[model samples]
Target: METMMLGVYKIPEITINSGIDWLGICGIVLTALIVVLGTWTTIKNFKNTTLSQEAVAEATSNRQFVHIKAENVAKNRQEWINGLRSEISNFISACFDVRSVYLNQSRPTGLVPELFEDFVTVENLERELKSKLIAAQGEARRCLSLIELYINPEEQASIDLVKTAQEIFHRAGDTSFNLTWECDDLVKIAQGILKCEWERVKQMV
Candidate 1:
């Protein structure tokens, strides 16, 4: 057995062996603690990395959804505008035709003598004018319907414009007591209103 001296004392053989054993046990315990701490740190880092990846993925998906929704809204709005433009143009053309037919029918010297054989008769002239007015009214109603379809009813500005157009259309129908005004004048006013609305929508888009 080997004897180890501490300070001025020579340690006994059995005491030395016991001390060595104690030191070995302490070393084992310290090694085990170090391993446990290393394992905990690794697990914590992995958990943080996984959470970060999941958050990034969720944010990307939300961004994509918003982009797609905006694209669809734009497409729908453009289609509505194109359709409304065509309908408004048709309405204006119909109003112009009604004005011309009414003036020609009422003229003493007929505008188209070959087309209107019964232009001199008051009854025939009035009947033709009534038919033309009814057709013009139909076109105007189509314009109103288009406005209702394309515009939000809650928007007060658009609603007021539509009301104005409706009043003008109804006024065009009254030809009582041999009184008639130029239909094109009302039609032109409606056209101006529609163009203004369209310009406002374009700015939003």
Candidate 2:
């Protein structure tokens, strides 16, 4: 053992060495603890940041998907509205054509045996008109079926439109059931349906 002198006081070398060793061990342990704490804090912050970013990305993706789907649906509905309008117009026009042919056939065309050649010509014209009327009726029926398919059966407007259209078709040649009034009603109902759909499309936009 050695003795160290400091200002007339004597300190043992073993005591000095032991104190330095204890201080060094405490310093090392404290440093290791600080490093562990820092690493844990950094890891925890990184995990929180990653989770937040993932949540934001997921929300953005969902909003974009919903917006795109709405646009597609609105576009499709617009096309459907245009198609239904055209079919309804065609159906009404064909019904009117059939009505006109029936009215012409029922009109009085005073003729005698002396005008037999003229009457034969009129008969030929009548046959041509009859053929055209048959074609028109067929076209109207086809359009009616297409319109029914385009409309929702559960809707009152759709039901009324289909019912009026059917009545017009069946009474087109009858000349007694107010086919024109029925057609007008059908047009009104179709207009209502189209207006409602247009409003819905505007909302999506």
Candidate 3:
């Protein structure tokens, strides 16, 4: 009976902590920490994305509008150039609509596909039409200059002819090509008139 009692006392003296129990406690604590941290991170990212997305969209829209307006302005300026020479008596004012079509073509940015593509096309057309128009304007200016110089002091009949040619030059066709043709004729006529005027002036001298 005494030894049995001693054995019972020894059993009670053993540590209450178990290796398995400590491991289980630690695992539970780690699991709870992970859950809390994961939830916080997910919520933060979700909220930030929502707000930032709207701001990004607004910025993109503003840029798109600016680009569109710029394209329109360019179109308007070219049209004005085409129509600038028209007077009250003029009919069928020159309008270079093809210039607008020619204005579209350019490098694209990686924006929404449709808008970006339109901008690119407009730029390319602008470049081509610009070149053609510049040449046409130069030709027309030369025609006008030649008339003013060599055809101004001619006979009254010749003056009327030169003035008619001047009107034709100013009225150069609506199409860029047609305008080019008109300017070519004016150029030829002006050269002929200049030759006559120089000879007549030389004889008078």
Query: Which model scores highest in lDDT?
Result: 2
Q: Summarize candidate 3's per-residue lDDT along 75-108 as a digit string, tens digits.
A: 6544433332232112112222223323332334
Model 2: C-alpha RMSD to truth? Answer: 6.7
> If the candidates were sorted by their TM-score against the true structure, best first, what order would they fall in?
2, 1, 3
Model 3 off-target regions past 4 Å? 1-115, 175-205
Q: Listing every candidate in turn, what is its Cα RMSD in Å to the true structure after a full C-alpha superposition?
A: 9.3, 6.7, 28.0
Alpha-carbon lDDT of model 2:
0.90
Please give each candidate's TM-score: 0.58, 0.78, 0.31
Across 41-147, the per-residue lDDT of candidate 2 in tens digits comes to 99999999999999999999999999999999999999999999999999989998998888888886675536879789778878988998999899999999999
Worst 10 residues of 1 by lDDT: 173-182
Candidate with the larger TM-score of 1 and 2: 2
Provide the overall lDDT of each model, using Cα atoms, as 2-decimal numbers.
0.63, 0.90, 0.53
